[model samples]
Target: MLSDMTATTLDVPAELPFLQSLSWFDAHWRELTPYQMLQRYERGWRHRGVTADLSHEEAAFLRGLIQRFGSAIDVPA
Candidate 1:
């Protein structure tokens, strides 16, 4: 059924290095709080030359991440 599957387009606000976005709690990721990481995430999304679309299972997983902490990501005035 591989040929019958349709690809879905996902808009990930930010793209992490080597798909590091999935490792939200890794020690390196822990270095920055969710708020801090979210800030950098927004910035990266803004200037990222590569497209931020993930049309696969990871896309669904990352969307969950955004939904989980998106409300808390804020930039200072």
Candidate 2:
């Protein structure tokens, strides 16, 4: 089973299409910085107590996003 931290971090990509389709990026793009999103993910991971098991595609997507946008979220050491 994946830990809560992992699940929360992985959820970002899954929500990307919906966020974009809703035009959230255009309206609140400034307010929704990558760092802020990472912070939210960290908090969510702490709250959920369970992590996600990412598929290969999901992993690749996240890596690409991180490389493109830059992430402030850090995996637990």
Candidate 3:
């Protein structure tokens, strides 16, 4: 389980497009700073939780997204 360290109840839309929902997650946690929220997204998706239920293609794309850019996220601008 990706440690649900924060006691948050995100209102993510189950039927929303993958990218859109990700953007939403990003926007929602803006206070945490982009880097911080991105880390949370990566962590949240790492274990079997909400993101675990994503479709295979979606999950692959997410993994690809993380691999391509998330691996070395720069400080939030």
Using Cα atoms with residue i matched to residue i, what is each candidate's TM-score against the true structure? Answer: 0.34, 0.33, 0.32
lDDT of 2 by residue, 1-77 (tens): 32432333333444343223333336663345444444444444333323444345534654544554467544322
**Highest lDDT model number:** 1
lDDT leaderboard ranking: 1, 3, 2
Model 1 TM-score on a 0 to 1 scale? 0.34
Clashing pairs in 1: none
Q: Please name the candidate that would achieve the greatest TM-score relative to the true structure.
A: 1
- Candidates in order have lDDT scores of 0.44, 0.43, 0.43
Instruction: TM-score for candidate 3, please give it.
Output: 0.32
Window of ten residues with lowest summed lDDT in model 1: 1-10
Candidate scoring better on TM-score of 1 and 2: 1
Give the least accurate 10-residue stretch of model 3, judged by summed lDDT. Answer: 1-10
What would the per-residue lDDT of candidate 3 be over residues 1-77, giving only the tens digit for each residue? 23343323443334424333445546554355333444655655434334334555545544544543455422221
Q: In lDDT terms, how accurate is model 3? A: 0.43
